[model samples]
Target: MTLVQRELVEFQDVLTPRAISQFLGTEAWALHSRRSFMETWVHDSGVGRSLEYVHIPTDRDAPDFSRRLQETASTLSRVYAISMGELAERVSAIRADLFFVRIARDSADGTIPLRQASGLIDSIEKMMKAAAIVTANPLAKGTGRTSERVRNFLDDDLRMGHTKRGSFIITIAARLHDDDIGHGADDPGAPEREGPAAANRVTRREGRADEPTIDFSRRVMTTLSRSLAVTRRHLDHSDDFVEFEEARESGMTAPIVEAIEEIATDSGGARVDMRFSWTSALPHEGLSEEPVIFTPTAIERAPRVIERFARSAGVPANTDVVGPVIGLSRDTRAAGEEEGDVIIQADVRGSVKKVGVTLSGNDYNWAIYAHRHRLPFTVSGILGKKSGRWWLLDDVEVDASFLIARQHDRIERLGGDAPEDPAAPVDV
Candidate 1:
């Protein structure tokens, strides 16, 4: 096979643009709350600035701080059973709003006008309280860990001497999948986000004409994409930290957390970790980095092709099967299926059967996805009962990235009512 192209691509996510948006939307309030936590304590002065007095000898906030930290930890245990490392890696990075920090800092120096400072303290406190409540919500447990981390980020850094004086921004870059063969404009392989920078409102440091408009989508894509298919071991929270027992009882998989330690490791490129410092600039130098490129050698052809078999013959009322498939034969007749309807064949264990499907109109995408990927398809209903293929489905789901793409495409055919799936950022 002749290799065509190969390169590293980095983005916050690999899911379809729409799913990524939804996932990011879920994390948005969490990010805002986490940032608010940092601002409350650190005041954005960077190194050596977090609740500076809290770590001192006469610190009155210590007890409450510790209690709150513990409270946050308990909330986390209730909802998220992920590991500390996973917690750190999966949390989104939200940059501090320097404006609020600056105003507060200036007030201390008597430079801020009384008008600006009057309700400012009240407003800040309100925001902090709101943030605390948001973080404590078990329904969005990821924020609990993020809240703790952001609240203590500066202090931890100061203790470790990793604190830098300037404001920190989150940066993103894609490391292309090592095995990614190639990408085309229309395919999912391309992670290039087609839009302005994720955050369009960039403030250029007076002399820095080279400032880059950061892409919020890029940051989001990277954050959520990295979280996919990854699962941490279940932790047993002691009685002191137990609150959401019902959450634990229901299990953590409903929110789509899975054990992807192996599959995630093999499938995607390295995840650009955003845990410690959320610098807005990635490693490629300048504001943003280019998408890593890759070469495609030769596409492997599947051994079999399952064509869609027409259900012309009498069919049993109950029959279903799932397994690898081949393309349909050309001779089959079509009922309600569209023009590209291919025959499908699945052999569960040892039973092999063939069948065709009349779909629920073209309202769903993946109209030709099976044909494109040739993956296993489940055949159920009354069509293939005579072939002795019954109840063979294992109910394993396809990846969300693929599932959404198929869904998004179908909804598009229904005219103007379909919501467009956002363009997804691929790698980094």
Candidate 2:
């Protein structure tokens, strides 16, 4: 498609010499010549055609720099049969895998509710971290503190991009390391130099011997795709929790399951759709481009899968515990004590038990609302027994959606003339 003038202008605004070089180099375009203020890159488009050259300005102060850059982009777009914006986006993510995660709901304007937005972002981060940890060590549990290596991968390599206005889309760019790019002569797309000797020479530097040949970005994406695929299939076919146990070796872990559960619940049961775009710099093998979706039914069944796997691992696992408020501890007299603490009788591991969970901040307020309304309360955390009593250990999220749903139901039942919702104080 021909790129419009607006598209060319937008691409020119962000295009730079370095980004152009990276894109050209990755696409196997050879460096033909270098001038004082400009560099020429040539690509041998096969099938009996002359070599094509693109002139890139080395200095922004060069004459007609923006016009030259736009011309270069337009030429590339025509040659590749793509749009200027597409070319620019590919260049921008030349060294990264672009991941798009969208919440597919009834929001025609592409905006999500304020409360669900925070929950969605937190869940997406958790989900990706869990995938990365599992990629580093397939046997590793998805819970507890992340290792130093995994933390570095997330902090340094991963980046969050601008949000899109298409049903609440989140863009994540996972930067590819040196090990991720292919540079050997064996690669058909490897950049070739001018000389015969340089034609066979590797362009990019080799990674350290200690580094794994497979980069973390690709591996993590693969693990996430496979895990979500397996969970969706299992939830579709079986009611037995043993299926999760069987799928343990397939990267089905507690944290990923819990993360999906939280995301689905926080979206008010909307399906989560995730799309992965592999970087063009390297060869991607056996990874599907099809979107991975976590349906509402699968999410509803996720809690059991997490609980079953947690039992097999013999450790405190993350899962959602939902039930009515059985008791509350308002005693703030003790040291480090706060009012509005909650105790709920929820079904845990096949039997009903009283699960105690401490609350503060918005969570404390939500607990009070649920108790006053006699609505079911849901919280996710590490479920374990302490002093013969069950307690949610860490990272407790007091879901406020239940209160909202209950209030909505009450309004409907009262012929649309119910009192103001008590849950209105909480945004979620």
Least well predicted 10-residue stretch by lDDT in candidate 1: 298-307
Q: Which stretches of candidate 1 lie over 4 Å from their true place?
A: 1-214, 218-256, 259-279, 282-377, 381-428
Residue lDDT tens for model 2, 1-428: 34466776555533566566667766758778766567788898897998888897766676787677778877888889976666767776666777788888887677878767765776677778878887777667655557787898889988876565567888887877744443322233444444223322223436665433566776787787777767666765655333655666766766667666766666778888887877666556677768877778767677667657756767555768898887787766645534556888665543344678877755766777777777788998988644334578887877788676776786778777654655553322
RMSD of 1: 26.1
Q: Which ranges in model 2 have alpha carbons more than 4 Å from their true place?
A: 1-14, 26-30, 42-52, 61-64, 77-84, 162-166, 178-212, 238-242, 314-428
Q: What are the models' TM-scores?
A: 0.19, 0.63
Instruction: Write down the RMSD of candidate 2 (Cα, Å).
Output: 12.2
Q: What is the C-alpha lDDT profile of model 1 across 1-428, one tens digit per residue?
A: 11111100111122222222212222311112112122111112245743211111112234554344333323332335753222222332222111111111212333434433332333222223223323344354232233553344222311111111222212222222111112211233334332223222343456877974333323333333322212111222323222233433332221122111111121221121113233232222322222211111100100000001112112334555454434433323545543333345553222233444433223112324545555455545543221221222332222235434654565566543444433221110
